[model samples]
Target: MEWRGRRQSSNIEDRRAEGPVGGGFGGSGPGGGFRIPVGSGRGGGLSIGTIIFLVVIYFVFKAMGIDLLQVVSGGQPTPAGYERSAQESSPGEEDTKAFVATVLAETEDTWNGIFKANGETYREPRLVLFRNAIQSACGNASAASGPFYCPADQKVYLDMSFFDELSQRFKASGDFAQAYVVAHEVGHHVQNLLGILPKVNEQRQNMSEAQSNQMSVRTELQADCFAGIWGKYTQQKGLLEQGDLEEALNAATQIGDDTLQRRTQGYVVPESFNHGTSQQRSTWFKRGFDSGQLSACDTFNNPV
Candidate 1:
């Protein structure tokens, strides 16, 4: 991917220095109710008990229509004892950060134009960078959960370390594959903007677990197709290098529910599959790439 020298997004929030495995919910400002400096005296670790307590607090605030996450993220001061010190990034990590920012900028440009063409406005989403763990409006999540977009906060949470895992563990390496990851999460943001997510959630409430999983597969496949739309845009701009598409396709295949399930449990259960199969993921992505039109990316009406 020819991402270098391109525009970098201003939506990145670097919380790497906050703490290792840092997460907390509920609090007005920095010290609203439970203000503790990460990486100071608490050994830079969050206990499971603390996380549960914060979750309880978070739901209480949510019931009252108060966003505790908003208050905590508003830049309140740290506690008296713990101080946040500076942390340095490696040269390679710095490049990765730049690359992610550039990809985010490209997605913003592409989605903005697409939304305007459809008589809608695109609201750009921020990307939050953290290490080990982070607290989101959805809930606290570890790096093992992978990257995700939070509808409540309209932010994408990521740990750059996932890239290493992608290559070393998932066998999906290459810059374009990394870009595909970003695009996929941004696709979720698009669905949220289009009110697709809430509708799907509502429908899922009355569905059986197996039926809900099927809906989830459809939703995920749609996002995959949306990512392919971005891939098409980049290809048209001559930004893709040789083997870039293959890298993305390989990524799509390797992360499929069937592939992961088979690898983990030595068997595949179609009814339990949430995301599409390996073949379906790559095929849907290719469908979107072959035709850059949004109509071609509809996974609901059409068969997978």
Candidate 2:
């Protein structure tokens, strides 16, 4: 991709130096209670009375349907002492940041024009750059979570090191592939703006696990298609080079749930597939790329 010297987004928040900020009660699962450590020091563990008080507080929050653990931990309670890898910083780290900002800017332009054309306003989402782990409205997440857009906060959280993983582990190397990651997350932001995410999430609540997974697959494929729409606009602006489309398509294929499951576990479970198969992912992306229209990207009603 010919993305140098392009306009970079001003909505980026660089928290790479801040490390992990918020601390919360430790837990083993989403509904797990707080873990109060025990030790043999004056400040080591809480008193029995203090523990009882905390238990009461936990129950009170639970009664109100609020997750106190999640609240104290920012969003999701991540493992303790999650730190950045020593190899996370490379010589091209600054360049990668620039490229990310440029790609975000491109998506902003594309979405803004699209929304304006439809007589609606486009709200650009803030993208946070963090090292290791970060707190988000959706939850606390590490780089292992990859890039995600939180509908609660309307922001995209990313750890740049994931690009390295995308290149090395997923074998989806290319500037356009990286750009596709950003665009896909931003596409979720667009879905949120269009109220697609809210509706889907509402419906998913009453669905079975398999039904929910199917709904999730449709939602993700639509985002892939939206990313393809952004790619189309980027190409029109002369920013895309030869093979850029292939890079993104390859990325879509590599990250498909079936492909990832097979690579990691040596088998694919069709019922658990939430992000669609490789063929579906690349096909939807190409569909949007071929016809840069929202009508072409409706994975919900259309047979994706």
Candidate 3:
């Protein structure tokens, strides 16, 4: 992709130097004066006062419909609203940052135009660059969680190290592949803006785990389609080169739930799939690329 010299986004927050921010409820601190006492006894059991304090806190959060344990476990909770790299400041790292910003800017341009045509204003979401771990409005996350869009914060969190993992571990390499990752997260931002995310989340509340996973698959596939829409626009702008499309398709295939599971666990669990199969991912993306229309990207109400 001929992305250099193009506009770069000003919404990037480079938090790599800040290291991992405080996580958990109340910013990873000792929750004011509610510290859990360390016992010197045989099992290092909690003292009565500590246990009582924890119980009170648990009930308090529960009353507010928040699961304290899940939050403590780094689980992303549903938003109440209607909604990072290890390397130093080297030239290579700087180039990656620039590439990400350019890709983000491209997404902004594409979505802004698309939304304007539909008589809706698009609110650009910020992208946070971090290393190791960072605290988000949704919850705490590490580099291992990959890139994610938090609806509660309307931001995309990314660790550049994931690009290395994508190339080495997933065996999907290319500048366009990296762009696909950024575009996919931005797609989630689009979903949030259109109120699709909050609505799907509301519906997921009544769904079983398997059913919810199915919904998640559809949601992710739609985002892939949206990313493809961006690809279509980028191509029309004469930025894409030969084999660029294949690079992105290979990326979608490499990270598919079935492919990842088979590689990691030597088997595929159909019901546990949340991001769709490899074929479905590539197919949906191609559908969007071919049509370049939002109506063609609807994963729901159509057989995906």
Candidate 4:
């Protein structure tokens, strides 16, 4: 939480000013761009009656891989109306940015040491900042998709607005919770470095949907454990304060697929869960925190 004076990672890609760059499959325009007809109500779009509803639905559909623009245009990317613009970051946002960079640097230090201990060198991954949307080697992403690490590009993508949603919507406030998010994504980078992500993804091709979801759960749980490992490292360095662990645990609970599904849909589907349950998430995180050993994060071999 107290990360103001800490080191910041230089591996940050400040693409916020770049807007959404194009480059996805079957898209058109100069930069492969596209646009969703907002409540402009122009050209037979929805009326103002369900403007807010439609906006929410749009993002939800986008998250579920239903690109409205692509669907409407038959896979043609439309040009952006506005030019690339950069907004001046507020003081709080600037501090948050610095905090993210600091957390990333610490993860780099921790993982580098960990890899060196195992006779390997850790290759640091870049963290990208963007607004609205960003294109990754894996695919195009919107902020609604949440933070993610793309192994294909060896980069982590984040939208800081998620922090506000974390605090206000999920009720998982606190600097530690924010740190946990960054650490969890970085954990994916670690898995990529170790070739675990590629192997698991390759195997998923042969798995049924349910079985693949189970594999994804294991992978996600391991990443949670890895984040806990970072927490353990910070705790050992006397960086953790009171209530920090609770913040992280609360965050894990709030973001559990079951918890989120229940909150949004008033129901839970266990088999559809790609991430673990709330208990599993918190438990695996605690396992790594208490043990502070990479061996303790073997969610695959062990009963998770």
Question: Which candidate's TM-score is highest?
Answer: 4
Residue range 1-304, candidate 2, lDDT tens digits:
9999889999898888667433334422111101010111123678899998998987676676665655676775434444344345566987998999999999999999999999999999999888767777766766656677888888887878888888898899999999999998898899999999989988989999999889988999999999999999998998889899999999899988778877776777899887788899999999988899999999989898
Q: How accurate locally is residue 47 in candidate 2, as Cα lDDT from 0 to 100?
A: 85
Backbone clash numbers for all candidates listed: 1, 2, 2, 2
| Collision pairs in model 4 | 28-77, 34-78
Give the TM-scores of the predictions, in the order they appear: 0.79, 0.78, 0.79, 0.81
TM-score of 1: 0.79
Every candidate's lDDT: 0.79, 0.80, 0.80, 0.79
In terms of lDDT, the poorest run of 10 residues in model 2 is 30-39
Question: What is candidate 1's lDDT per residue for 1-304, written digit by digit as tens?
Answer: 8888999999999887776223443222110111100111112667899988988987776677565655676844333333243246677878889999999999998999999999999999999887766778877776656788888888887879889978887899999998988888898889889988888888989999999889888888888898999999999989999999999999899888888876766777789888789899999889888898789978889888
Q: Weakest 10 consecutive residues, lDDT, candidate 3? A: 31-40
Q: Candidate 1 regions off by >4 Å?
A: 21-86
Which runs in model 4 stand beyond 4 Å of their true positions?
20-87
Deviation from native of the Cα of residue 182 in model 2, angstroms: 0.2
Residues 1-304, model 4: lDDT tens digits: 6787888999999887766333222221111111110111113656677887867876677666565655565654434343344456577877888999999999998999999999999999999987757788777777656788888778888878888988898888999999999899898888888888888988989999999889989999999999999999999988898999999999998888778777776778899888788898889888889988999998889999
